[model samples]
Target: MTLQTVILAAGMGSRLGRSLPKPLTELSDGRTIMRQQHDNIFAAFGDDAKITTVVGYRAETIVEAFPAADYVYNERYDQTNTSKSLLRALAATGKAGVLWMNGDVVFDPRILGRAIALIERDQSFVTVNTAKVSDEEVKYTVDAAGHIDELSKTVSNGIGEAVGINYVSARDKKAFMRQLARVGDQDYFERGLELAIREDGLRLAPMDISDLYAVEVDFAEDLERANLYV
Candidate 1:
């Protein structure tokens, strides 16, 4: 299957307060956070995956980090969130359904490979990267069947964390983009998708993953933990 990756790198890194995009932040291994993720995805998927990074805030930094990759710039990144960045990139994807990922994360490439394999198995599905949540984790409530039942960080009512990776078909990707273009005003990726699924009744197939220690870099504590593990 021909796969493309959309790495969402549009955050301003408010908690880091470094006056730089989160993706450009340095990692322990001397590689920038964005460079590590780009290399991870590229190394894992190889020629099969054409990677596109959705950039904003310090978009130039992201571009400099991975000039070989395709990109979509989101000027409204400050007012919006992940979904908007996704929408911009998805639109630029034109007719291909690809994997969606977060830029400010540290994880094993095998986790991404698992999700890609699942997508290749079934075209009309969504494979979400999941991890066993700890005290420092953002938990997602997964049903016995492995579908995400709910998600929470402060309430501790979830079973796993969303690793910010998914495999979707071109049809669903187009539909999602269309819906986002219509009413993605809230700018939350989850909210836009929930609206589409609830109102439009789009069914998303779920794949359960167990091969990664994925950490999303949101705050200082998350950065510390991610640096240590991923």
Candidate 2:
């Protein structure tokens, strides 16, 4: 099956203090964060990967940079959040399961290799870094069955940090889409996942990639750390 990959790039990223879309921010390796992501997808999936970017908050810039990519525009980008942007992409894509990531993350390419089996098995999952759990980042807790029970920035005593990369199996796509639609405008996509797990019994496994480098560039310091891995 051809892998469908989406990049959530609609956020204004005001915290990063960049005029350009956060995904377009340059890394030390000369590739923009999104560019690195694009390369990683292609490297891991080869020609079997289809890429679609959800663009807003300077959508033109991201579109112009990657003319080959498919795009879905988020008209209420400034007013909405990741849940809406991700909803738009999911609605626009085909029936295949999707692998998606936040636009600003710079991660080790090997992480994708690690996820291939899960994708092929049609397992829904979130990539996590068990080595660090920061308050500002999205955190997760597992249920008795070891499935993701809680997911959000405010999750206390979380086992790890969700690294902004995730996959939704085709089997769970419609259920997840419904949950996403029910979320509040400003709620992150994690809220939708939480609802899906609670209301629909969606089992989301947490894939630990703590041994690999994955940084969501939300600030100058984050960019510095991501650059170190680039």
Candidate 3:
């Protein structure tokens, strides 16, 4: 199966306070967040990568950012969530499986490689990269095998950190879009994916990830600290 990787970058990023989308915001090295993310993806897959970026908010900013990568706009990004954004990109491509990610995350290639390698080996399996979260960091719950147990937004107590990346197996484009549309009233993509796993009986695998992992940038402080790596 061919893999189409879509960067979910539809949010306005009110927390970053930038006039630009958070992915368009400049990293410390002077490279834009969007560029950094794309570069990492490109380095991983090179010519074999079928990359498409899902843009919203300042969609033009993303258009300007990855002039080479294909784009699909999610105009309802403000009201909806990443699941909807992902659905838009998936619909644009008539493919079977997709590799998905958050544009605002700071990740190393090893983490990305772990996820991609799983997809290449197992056609029907989903890969999750989870870290052991610190007391002060964002939290998630993980099953014994490291599949995502829960991405509780109100997760004040947990030991796992979701790496914000996955490879999805789509039965059909329409079915995936219908699943997304069904979850329009929900929070983020995790909720929708969970609902899919629960209702549609989807089971995912875990990437060989350890405690230290990528950080998704949401606030200025996160952007500031990520500066060192960017």
Candidate 4:
């Protein structure tokens, strides 16, 4: 099956204290987040990569930086959150089996390859890192069978933090979108995934990446750590 990768890039990145959109921020190696992501995805999927990005908050700059990507604009991005931005991008494509990623995350290509491998094994799951999870990180809980039971920042004493990357299986796409529409504008996409998992039996799992390095660039310090990982 063809997989469409929709990156949610509409956030303002106020926490990072940067004027540039989070996705446009450059790493120490001089390559921007968008370029790194594009290159990684391209390397993972090659010519079959169908990448689409949702742009807002300096949308033109992201477009100019990654012109080859199919673009979807979220005009209400200032009021809405990543959940709305993600749904808008997915709605535009109308395709099943989507690969989702947060715009601010930087990781090795092996992470994407591993995610795709899990999807091919008929599992829809999010990548998790067990290295260290801060209080601000989004965490999840997995049952004895490895199925995710809950996902939230308040998920204390659970598994590691979420990597903000996931696969939505074709079987769950319809119900997933429906539940996502019910989420408030000021919510992350994980909220909808939780709903899909609990209400519609979406079979969402957690794939651990404790040995791998992946950084969600929420602060200047996180960016520095990500640079070292590269």
C-alpha lDDT score of every prediction, in listed order: 0.68, 0.95, 0.69, 0.86
Q: How does candidate 3 fare on TM-score?
A: 0.84
**Between which residue pairs do clashes occur in model 2?**
none
Candidates' TM-scores? 0.83, 0.98, 0.84, 0.96
- Candidate 1 deviant stretches above 4 angstroms: 122-157
Q: lDDT tens digits, residues 1-230, model 3?
A: 34588888888888888898888878778888777777777777775677888888989978876788888888788777787888788788775677788888876667666566566754333333344555544356556765555554556666555667777765523444566777755466666666665566555554546643466788888877788665
Clashing pairs in 3: none
User: Candidate 2 on 1-230: residue-level lDDT in tens?
Assistant: 47899999998999999999999999998999999999999999996789999998999999999999999999999999999999999999977799999999999999999999999999999999999888988999999999999999999999999999999999999999999999999999999999999999999999999999999999999999999999
**Cα deviation of 65 in candidate 1 (Å)?**
2.0
Q: What TM-score would candidate 1 get against the native?
A: 0.83
> Which sections of candidate 2 miss by over 4 Å?
none
lDDT score, candidate 1: 0.68
Q: TM-score: which candidate is best?
A: 2
User: Residue 124 in candidate 4 has what lDDT?
Assistant: 81
| Most accurate candidate by lDDT | 2
**74, model 2: CA deviation in Å?**
0.1
Q: Candidates 2 and 4: which is better by TM-score?
A: 2
